[model samples]
Target: MSPDSVLVRWLPVSAIAEADWPVLSALLPEDEQARAQRFHFRRDWESYTVAHALLRGTLTRLAAAAGHPVAPPDWRFSIGAHGKPEPILPEGVPPFRVNLSHTRGLAAVAVALDREVGVDVEWLDRTNLTIDLADRFFAPAECAQLVGLAPEAEKDALFAFWTLKEAYIKAVGMGLALPLGAFAYTLDPLSIAFDDRIQDDPDSWYFQRLRPTQGHVLGLALRHEAPERAMLDAAPAGLAALLRLAG
Candidate 1:
C-alpha cells in the first residue's frame, strides 16, 4: 500500500515494551520526556507506560512520513475545555492527529497525515461487566438494541457497538465529557447516528466495525469522509523503517 494511504496498525502491548526505548527515546523531544516522567507508573505501568511509549514511537514515525523533523517540540499539552489531550502543534508542519487505545495487552494506533483519527479495541470477556456499564454510558436506543439481542449473543455485540462509540467520541477529541447517551448506533455495523441531544456537528464523523478477532472486537473512527479503501498493516519493520531517517 502507498505510504500516504490511511493505515491502521495493531501492536501487542508486550512487543512494544520489548522495543528498544533508547531507540524510541532518541526520537522524543524534551517535552515528551517530562510528560513521561509525570505519570505514576509504579501502580499501573502496563497502561500508561506501554501506551505512552507506543504513542511516542508511532508519532515519531508519523512525523517522519510527513517529512518533518522526528523530534517533537517542547510544547506542553493541556486538556481541552472538554477534557481531551490537545498537543501544542509545532509550526510549519501539516496537521497531524493520532488516537490510541489498549485493552487486554493489545494496543491499536491510528495515524493520519492531516486529519483527526481514533482507534479502540476491547476484549470480549464472558463477564457481565459491559452490560452493567452500558446502562450508565450507552444511549437509550443503544441500550434498547442490547436488550433486544438474544441472551447468548448480546454481550459480544454490545461490546462491538460500545467500542465503536468510544472510538468515535475520542476521534472528535471530546472523550467521555461528550455525552454518549445522546447518540445511537445502528445494528447494521456500517453506520452510526447522533440524536438531538448531541451538541456537536455529526456530519464530519465516520465509524466502521472491524473484523472480529478471537476474544476481541475492534473499531476505528475518523473525522474525514470514509476512504475508498482502508488498509491494515502489521509490520513493525515498516514502521521502524519510516523512523530510521532521523537516526
Candidate 2:
C-alpha cells in the first residue's frame, strides 16, 4: 500500500486526560496551539488538540513514506477556495491528500496517495436528534424515503445518509460548497444517485461503511476500491505502526 493510498483511522477522544495533555499539546504547531486555545470549553479544546496531533502525525508518516521526508512542523496546510484543507507540496512530489473529522469522543482521518479521498464518523446516540433536517439537505427522493420510515427506522437511515453525503462532498474537495441535496443515497444494496449537477462519472468513485468500534458509523469515499482500514494503537508511535499494518 502506498502511504498516499486510501486509509481510514480513528482515535478515541473520550479517554484523553489532564495527564496526557502535556504531550498532546506539544505535538501541535504554534497556529494550532492558538486555534486549540480559542475553544472555551475543555472538551472542545482537548478534542481539537488531539485531532490536530493525529492529523500531523499521520501526514508526516505519509510524506516520509512517499520519500519526501518533511517534518511534521514543516508541513504546510492551506484551505481551498471552497473550504477543504489542502496540503502544500514541495516541488516534484507525488500527490498526498487527507481529510479530518471528529464527533464528541472520537476523531477520524482519511488519507489517499494518488487519489482524492474523504471520511466522516458520527456518534449514533443522540438525545435531541430530529429527522427533519433531511428535508432541507437531502435530495427529494432521499428526504421522502427517510421520512416514510417509522420514527425508529427513520433515525437509523438518516445517520447513514448524512455520513455518506458528507464523505462524498469532502472527497469532491468542495466541502459544503456542494449542497447535500445534490446527491441521493440508498442503504439496502448501498449506493448513491448523484444529480446532473455533478459532472463526474458515478463509477469513478467508491464508498464504504466502516465499523472499527462500537457506537460509531464511519463513511469513506475514494476514487479507487476498498481502502486499508487502519486501527489506532496506544503505543507512542501509534499511527506510524498502523500505516505499516495498512501497507
Candidate 3:
C-alpha cells in the first residue's frame, strides 16, 4: 500500500465459518498454513481459526489496495526474544507491518509499513475486577484511581484502564515480560499516559479508547512516528470489504 495508507479492521469471531477458510487459506504461504493449523490445535480451535482468518482477510485487502498480489507476500514473521512478532522482511516487496489481537468474540488487525504498530481489545466484565487483583496487576496510582470511582462506574473505568495498558504493552511487543506495575496509566476514560519509567520513550507510545459495547472495550496503540489516524470497521461484511480492498 502507499506509505501514507493505514488500515485497521475489526472482525467478529462469531461471524466466521468453515466456508470462509478458503479466503484465509489463500492468503497464507504454504508454510504459514501449516503453522496456523497447528496453532489452532494448540489453542481454542474456533478462536485461533477465526483470528487467523480475520488477519489474513485484512492483509489480503491491504495488499490488493497497494496493487500487490492478493496472496501472502514472501516475508516471514517470527516471535522476538521477548515474544513480540516481527516480520522477516523479504526483498522486492514494499516494507509491510502488521499487528493482531483477539478477545472474547472480536478480532482486530492493524496494517501499515515503515513503522511499528500494535492493537488490542478485550470484553469487559465488571464482575471480574477485584481490588486485590487490581493491586497486584495495576500500578499503585491506578489502584488508587480505581478505588475512588463510584461503585457502578469503577468496574467499567478499571477495565478501560486495563485495556489501554495492555494495548500499550502489546504495542511495545514485550508482552507481559514488561512490568505492568512499573508504569502508571492516567485514569482518563479515552486517553492514558505512562509513568516515569516510560518517559524517555514517551513519543513511541499512545493509547485511545475505541467504540465500547456491552461487555467489551477496545483500544489501539501505535508509535508516534506512524500515521495518527486509525480506521476501524466491524465484522463479517467489514472483513470481506477489507479483503476486497486489498485485492
Candidate 4:
C-alpha cells in the first residue's frame, strides 16, 4: 500500500453464509453485537454485523501496517461531537482517521493516515430517489443539474450528488447539523462550491464516486489530501477466512 493511498473496502452481506455469521459477529465488541441484535429484521442485523466487523478488521490491518499492532477485538472507539465513531489509538501512534457506511446488502469502509475520511455506499434501487427529494435536500444548482437528464441518468446523478454530499458531511463529523444545501457539487469533473453559511475550502478536500458492485454506488471524501486517491481492496476475505486471517 502506498503512503498516499486511501484504502476503500466493501463486502456484500449476502456473501457471508448463515452458518458463518456467528463467526463474523464474534469479531465485534459486545456493545456492537447488542446493537446488531436490536435490528428488527435479520437482514438488517446481518448488514450491521458485517459492516462493523469489516471496519474492525480493516482497522486492525491499517494500525498494524503503521506499526501500532492493535488487535481487532481490542480496538476502542469514541463518538465525535456529532455521532461519527472514531478510533482510539495509543499515544505516539500517528493519527488514523476512518469512516464506514452500510446499506441494505452492502457495507463499505474508508481509512486514511493523519487525514479525515468518510465513505458512503447505497443500494442502487432505492425507491425514494426523486426530484422532489432532491429539491428538498440538495443545493438549488445541484437539483437544477438533475433536470433534463434522462430518467436513468438522472438517478445516477442524484446518487452521485447525494453520496458526495453525504461523504462530505460525514467527514466533517457534524452529521445533519451541517445543512446539505450549504455546499453544492458539480459532476463531469466533480467539484464543490460553498455558500457563506459554511466555512470550508473546496481545494483542501478530495471526492470520488465508484460503483463497487452493479447494485451499489460508493462515495469517498478525504480532507487535507487533494492528490490522495482512493484504492479499493478487491474484496474482503470470506467471512470464515476473515477471523483467522492476520491483519
Candidate 5:
C-alpha cells in the first residue's frame, strides 16, 4: 500500500467461526475486554468485541507492512479531546491516522499513512429512520432532499446521509461538538456543503461511499493537502483471512 492510500478492512461478525472468537477477543486490551463484558446482550458483545479486535489486527498489519512491526496487542492509542482515537508510536515510526465504525452485523477500520481519516458503516435495515428524524439531525437542505425521496428509497438515502455526516465528524475529531446539521452532503457527486459553524475547506476533503455488503452502507472521509485523489485498498471479508492477505 502506498503512503497516500487508505486501507479499509471489514468483518462480518456472523461469518467468523465460533472457535476463532476467543483468538480475536484475546487481541483486545484489558480495557476493551472489560467494556465488551459490560454489554448486556450477546449480539452487542459480539459486535463490540469484533469491531475493536479487527481495529487492532488492521493497525498491527499496517504498521508491520510499513516495516515498524508492532504486534496486534502491542499497539497503543490515546483518545483526542473530542474522543477520536490517536495512535501512539515510537520516534522513528511514521504517523498514521485511523477511524472505525461498526453496525449490527459488520465492523470496519480505515487507516491512512499521514492524513486524517474517518470511516462509518451502517446496516441498511435500521429501524425508525423517518423524515422527522432526518429533519432533527440533518441540515435543512438535506432534510428537504429526504422529504422528496421516494418511500422505497428514503431509508437508503437517510443512511447514506447519516454515514457521510458521521464520517466527517469522526475525521474532524470533534464528535458531536461538530453539529450534524452544520454540514450537508449531496449524494449525486458525493460533495459536501458546510454551514457557518464548521471552519473547514470543502475542497481539501475527500469522501467515498461503499456497499461493503448488500445490507450495509459504508462511508470514508479523508483530508489531503494535494488534489490527488486517494487510493482505496479495501478488504471486505473476514478478519482472519484479511490478516493473512495483508501480511
Candidate 6:
C-alpha cells in the first residue's frame, strides 16, 4: 500500500450463519473470547465476534501479504488509556493505527498507511437520539447551526455534527478526554477549527462523510503528516471504491 492509501471495510453484523461461528470464533484471542462470553445475549456475542474477526482479518491480511505471515488468530491487542485498541505487531512489521465503530447491524473499520485514523458509523434512525443532548456537548456555534435548521432537517444535521465530533476525538485517541466544545466544524465548506486551546491544526486531517446505506451514516477521518492540495484527490481509486462495499 502507498502512503496515501486508506481502506474502509464494513461487514453486516446482523446476519451470521451458525456454521460460521466456530470458524469466526477461532480468530478471536482468548481474552476476547472471555469478554464475548460475558455478554448475556447471544446476539451481542455474535456481533462482538464478527466485528473483532473482521478487524483481525484486516490485520492478518496486512501481515500475510509479505508471503510468510502469522495466522490471523495469533494476533493480540493492547488497549490504550483512552480505550483505543492497538495491535501487537511482530518485529519487521509496519504498524498502523486503527479506530473502529459498530452499530446493531453494521460495523466499519478504517485502516490507513501510517497515520492515526478514526471512523464512526451511526444508525440514522434518529428515534433513539435527541437534539436536546446536543446542547450539553456541542460547541456553541454547532448548536446554533443545529437550531437554525428547518424542523425537518434538524435530525440530519444533529447526526452529522455528532459523528464528526466523535470521529475527531477518536482520532485523538482520548475518547471524550478531548473537550467537545473546544472545536467547531462547518457543514457549508466541510472545514473545522479548534478553539485556542487545542494546538493541532485543522488542516492536518482529511474527513469524509459518507452514507453507504440508508440505515447508516459514516464519518471517516485520517490525520495526515503534511498538508497537500491533492490529498483527497490522491487517495487510491480503490479507497473510495472500498467504501461502496460497506453496504
- Reference-based TM-score, model 2: 0.83
Best by TM-score: 5
Assess candidate 4 and give its TM-score to the true structure.
0.92
TM-score of 6: 0.86
Model 2 lDDT per residue over 1-247, tens place: 4642466667777555566666666667788889888999987887687777777767767667768766565668888787778678877556778788877777888777767788887888855446667776789978777756887688778877888888999887888989888888778767778789888666666777776457777788777543334322212236434333222
Clashing residue pairs in candidate 6, if any?
none
Collision pairs in model 5 = none
lDDT of 6 by residue, 166-233 (tens): 88888888899898899988887777889997999898877877775678887877888554521432
lDDT of 6: 0.73
Q: For residues 105-198, could you state the per-residue lDDT of candidate 4 as single tens digits?
A: 9998888776778889899988897888999989999988998999999999999998998999999898889999999999978889999999
For each candidate, the alpha-carbon lDDT, in order, equals: 0.62, 0.71, 0.62, 0.82, 0.83, 0.73
Candidate 4, 142: how far from true, in Å? 0.5
RMSD of 3: 3.8
**What TM-score do all the candidates reach, one by one?**
0.74, 0.83, 0.77, 0.92, 0.93, 0.86
Model 1 clashing residue pairs (backbone): none
Clashes of each: 0, 3, 6, 0, 0, 0
TM-score of model 3 vs. true structure: 0.77
Off by over 4 Å in 4: 1-3, 228-241, 245-247
Better of 1 and 4 by TM-score: 4
Which model is ahead, 3 or 4, in terms of TM-score? 4
So what's the TM-score on candidate 1?
0.74
TM-score of 5: 0.93
Better of 3 and 6 by TM-score: 6
